[model samples]
Target chain A: MSRKYAAKGIFLLLLVNLLLCIFYVSAGAVNISPADMFHAFLGDGKAEYQNILVHVRLPRMAACVLTGSGLAVSGAVIQNVLQNPLAGPNIIGVNAGAGLAVVLCSALFPYCYAVVPFAAFAGAFGAMLFIYALARKTGASRMTLIMAGVCVNSLLNAMADAVHILWDDTLTSAYGFRLGGFSSVNGKVLLPAGILILLVTAAVFLLEKELEVLTLGETVASSVGLHTTFFQFLFLLLAAALAGASVSIAGLLGFVGLLAPHISRRIVGEECRFMLPFCALFGAFLVLLCDLLARTVWAPYEMPTGILLSFLGAPFFLHLLLGRSRRRRKKHD
Target chain B: MIRCENLSAGYGEGAVIHDISWEAAEGRLTAIVGPNGSGKSTLLKSVIGQTSVERGGVYLEGKPLKQWRHKEMAKQIAYLPQSRNDASLSVFRMVLHGRFPYLAFPRRYTQKDEETVIRELKRMGISELREKPVSELSGGEKQRAYLAMALVQGAPVLLLDEPTTYLDLSAQMELMELLRQLVAEGKTVVAVLHDLNHALQYADEMVLLENGGLKQCGTSKEILQSGVLEDVFRVRIHILQDQYGKEYYGFSSEKRMRNETGPAASGHPKRLQIRS
Candidate 1:
């Protein structure tokens, strides 16, 4: 895509994001007017309107943006770093890792809220490094990496299930966590994870050039004086941190990581400088859009954002798979 | 100058080239030539610290290869490997990555870096390709763009492995001429070549390898006169002169030698034949 066209698309996406933010705060179960919502934000509205907007919708909105941008940027980083378009936090067991950690932490800590993000980070980072190490050791191909992810993902999710089944009351709402709704998100949980996501995403942007060099592959990257191993590890660390922290707030959200970056790649070219920010914006937009649909589409009886995401994301994933296979078949032909 | 002393190196736990000592002088185009699997590529790779040196070490400007950090080494030596990734970056962005070692914190490309990239692109006749993705370029054009990238690195020593592999005959000639130009401009260039004729025609010095060991390292005339090329390759060479009276090397394979003999068997007119 040309720079001017890409710039236009980005501006449009940003505009949509802003409009969605306003609509998200306004069009909830009780339907606070835009005027009331703005007044609530400024500490002058009806007591009920102020309470719902301040306590519930605002934090949920923040969770949506944080989870969206975090997972999307993580997806972009994993795709580029691993040289696999199919790899995402959800696909590659990263969210499952965080999910398992969150479950375990809840089962163990019971009362502590601050420990979940760190626990999730550790879990996600471990899973990423394990998968990466396995790939390196086996000299894995594109398909093999996905296969490894599937294996790790299934095992971790099963372990989390075993934990949930063994201790019933350990989770306040196990289904909601699994399906990834922002309904349970509170300020205490969102604050630390939000700070983490913002800092890590900023760090990723700073390393955009280094990440670009890494896409040149190991030999060329090393030849050009890039510490390939170190950078690869570092990027994976950032990717894990983003995915884990997001999962801490929003339960195993499946496709934002996969869908957002791919969509951003289509709009802007894959230059990290452009792709990273675009992916973040598009990711935030997709989640906010899905969350809005989750709450308003059903009205009063809300569905989990994960269900809506899967509804939108699964078909896109299938299309990607079929398209890739068709292209491979054409090449073979 | 790159000097390897008693170097035995290879990938993990095995040495492909053993106990080899060679020197590539300043401002000379040295070609390493050998048959397939004879470790010519490995020898070139060792200079850039790509291989595990089992016994000895490579010295760049009298300092040990291990002593220089990656960025410091990159500023001194530009190495181009045999295979490259088809990156989806624009040609200008791809080449501007040559300035990676110089940039600090955020690694943003400066105006000087952009100017250097543009100059190298113009030098390579690919200024129009600056915005095009490298993956979309032709084989020869991609090679030139990569060469431009290496040039923008502004290193004194350039190492290339099979740079002419995927190029056409004309493109091969152009690349060889460019290497000569680089050498003439006082850059030390060492290339691994497969074509012995190109080695003989263009190289200031030739390092001949046979079965992962150095057979000879000398000027083209010395290597040609020494007969080691014929002995190791098991092919007869004809030092032919063109119509312009400039000399070039030609060879006949052993399979051809079995069925055909002399200059007539090679099937050319008398004007093309200068020696048997």
Candidate 2:
């Protein structure tokens, strides 16, 4: 049965995720041995190992998994709502909006780190509404939505750049945020981000059936008693919250949103019930793997995982575009 | 029964269907026939609240349509839009979506829901194709799958827009026969059709629309006898009776009488003709 296969696929993905998690946690800067990791788990490790495990590695790892899963799941939801394979938080201005808000918050408040995530969520939600309005005004075609998102992204990024120029003290952090990584993440950022992702992800799961009906197109969905506009708005808001939380933790991280959901779709077809969990695990594995490579590949001179992801994601994006066109041609034939 | 009281609806500024008052009788198959751009689909959409009704209202079972909640309305009336996209859903999953109005959120499909889907698929003669992806099915098979989805909704009133658009002749006849069977089972069936002969043969009542307004609404025999279709479609029609006394209709563009004499211009030159 398809259900059995889906269960097995989810299990395999979770297993892979666990393996990557261990690999990431053990091979970090301090290079904790497996024995030390076990000791730390048992609360019998040395002070140095315990400090590194609890204070440093755990938060960073949690940030990686949460950001990755949040972005990918948001991407899947946005893609279904918009009915565009290329739709993602990064491509649709959600991440850019959140990043811009964070930068502006840092510039304006200077010392209020607590306000950044809230501001990011507000900015992302505002950007989504603006894009939806523009799309509706222009008939809400797929191309118009993407174009509006691209324009909003450019405008918000330019504003963020202006803020950086205006506040010299925020410039260094803003630049680091722009080239996203987990270098500066701590429990302060991880806790709220994790909670937000968990809540929104649960909501998305509850909407799995609606999302499936939505994929058939708005008219069909509405005909089946679904309040299409209301559900679309709710799902978009959830997606924005997920993107905003991820951006709050890892600044402007791109491609995981676009890539992980796509890969999950290939593995699990388009059923959201299976695709959502698969996307979470695959996304976590991807980011954890990328983070591990970023740390180990250059050793002392580490690269940002976002940069590594873009390097891998651009070609994958093109492949999707080309494959879609080819399939369309085949359909016509 | 579904009734519209001077309903005017469209996408945006201008109304596509203007001030049309009509009713589809219960336990009968009604067909709406119109030429291209005559707003047949828009009229059906207005009934299901898919279009913006700029003026007037629609009623279902004596209650204003807007007063009914979405799930409640869906339980009363099932709608099948013109098949456009080739969705990648499996036939079984597609039919399962019809149970959406009945199932609460976050609840899995119950055994009863699955039984209904399977029964509908069997009725559609597509039980064997249940696990197949809908996108890979033939056009007739896909339409049947969509029909199965609509049937599983278990609504008393069914509205279908151009259900036979992409079907071949036999498939079209099969679907029409299936609709007639649904009507025989006491469900109200309404469809927008282009083929006048099929509408005449299968429908109990016919509603003709032209230029966004209702042109005629009567029994199929009455509409045929009135000969309003020729004027509405800008064509000449011939109603023929075979030896068995079965009535059929044929259509041709209005013939032109040529002033100049030529071998090709003898009598009335037949332009394009469609014979049923």
Candidate 3:
């Protein structure tokens, strides 16, 4: 996009974000008053308002922001590392791997929510390794990699189902997680995941220059003295850690990891300096807006945040995908 | 000197370059020419330790390639791959990646790196396209951008694969002139090229590669003779001296067509004189 237009777009989004933050805090089951929200902001609200603001609203808002940045930056990094437009933690196998891990934990034992995420992290890491190795073998096997991810997901899912069938009590008990939502955020799981994402994100930004060199291809990257093997592993790890951690807290947000960064790149430009940060912000805004709508759009009865995201994010995602195609066509004409 | 002592290249059980020994002197533009699949690119990759050379290794100033780490190699030898047509990089960032090997553990690009990149873009005359995405650039612009990246690598020995493959007439001449200028400034450039005319015009030295080994290695005056080229390339060629008193060659066009049809023709001129 034109730089002027991108600047304008970002400015407008920032304004919308401020409005959404205000509006989101006022929304929920209790239907708190905006005037009371102002009091809470001014540090002199009533007990209930303070309780809602401090406990319920702030953490969720922070989650929106954190998850947004995590998924978006994760997507951008994955795409560049894989050298494929469609490559990301969600669209490729990383999320599936994480999801598989979560399902595995949920299946194997009936007692540990925390271990599910570690399982998720391991699964995501494995998936990324598979993709990299598969690509080197076949020369740009993105579609095949995605296919491999899907197959792995299905097979794990069947394992999950079989476990569910055998242990019928377990299946019915952990059903909420399998469906995907942000209904619960335990500090034990949530805090570490949050900190992990931040650390990984910092590392990614730090490696931005090396990542840029990496996209030039392995031989070129190596000739210039980059440890291409290690760099590839670094990016793959970053994507896995972020996605696995996020999915553990919020089950399978789906495509935000792919969609967010690409949109950020289009809006801001391909400099990772611009792309990574903008993707993170816009991604957070997208998730927050969806979560807010999940609470308010139907009024008093909340939709799953995943379903709400699908309703809003999919059209935008399709528009971008088709937009990319139209662009390639126009470049010639 | 950049030395390759008994260097070998292969992947998964087959070696292409076998025990090859050579040294590229500093400040010399050495051109390597070979037929298709003569393992020129393989040799370049192996020199930088891109491909696993199972038998031998490269040395820069008497230190083994393995003794110094990857980043150290980057500081010494820069390799430019054959140009890829599909990638989106701005001219500015493309050159900036050349600074990759120099960045420390918590790597951050320094302002000095930017200055060096801009300096290269200026030298290449593509400073105007600094912000333009690489996809939109003309053939010459892309070549310059890649060359700028190699310069950013800050290596004494610059290895390029077909640096002029996609260029137009004037662009080719301009790139050759730039390379000559680089050699004058005490940088060594090793290029793999198919164009004999380019090698004859600018290279200080030339090496002919055939069937995964060096056929002849010498000065351009010695190595570029029609007889040597014919022996190396498996085709007859004739030489002509240009107005500048330097030799150049062209295939005898009719003779080339006639030679393409058979292993040997009964009535061909000097059939006995030519070694098969």
Clashing pairs in 3: A68-A284
Name model 3 segments beyond 4 Å from true.
Answer: A1-18, A41-44, A107-113, A173-175, A312-333, B104-108, B242-244, B253-276
Error of 1 at A42 (Å): 2.8
How would you order the candidates by lDDT, starting with the best?
1, 2, 3
Better of 1 and 3 by DockQ: 1
Model 1 bad stretches (over 4 Å): B262-276
Can you list the residue pairs that collide in candidate 1? none
Model 2 alpha-carbon drift over 4 Å, by segment: A328-333, B256-276
For model 1, report the TM-score of its A chain: 0.97
Residues forming the 10-long window of minimal summed lDDT in candidate 2 chain B: B257-266
What tier of docking accuracy does candidate 3 attain?
medium
Model 1 residue B132 lDDT? 93
> What is the Cα root-mean-square deviation between model 3 and the actual structure?
4.4
Better of 2 and 3 by TM-score: 2
Isolated chain A: TM-score per model?
0.97, 0.95, 0.86
Pairing residues by index, what is the TM-score of model 2?
0.94
Per-prediction DockQ: 0.77, 0.68, 0.61
Find the candidate with the highest TM-score and give its number.
1
- For model 3, state the Cα shift of residue A211 in Å: 2.3
Ranking by TM-score: 1, 2, 3
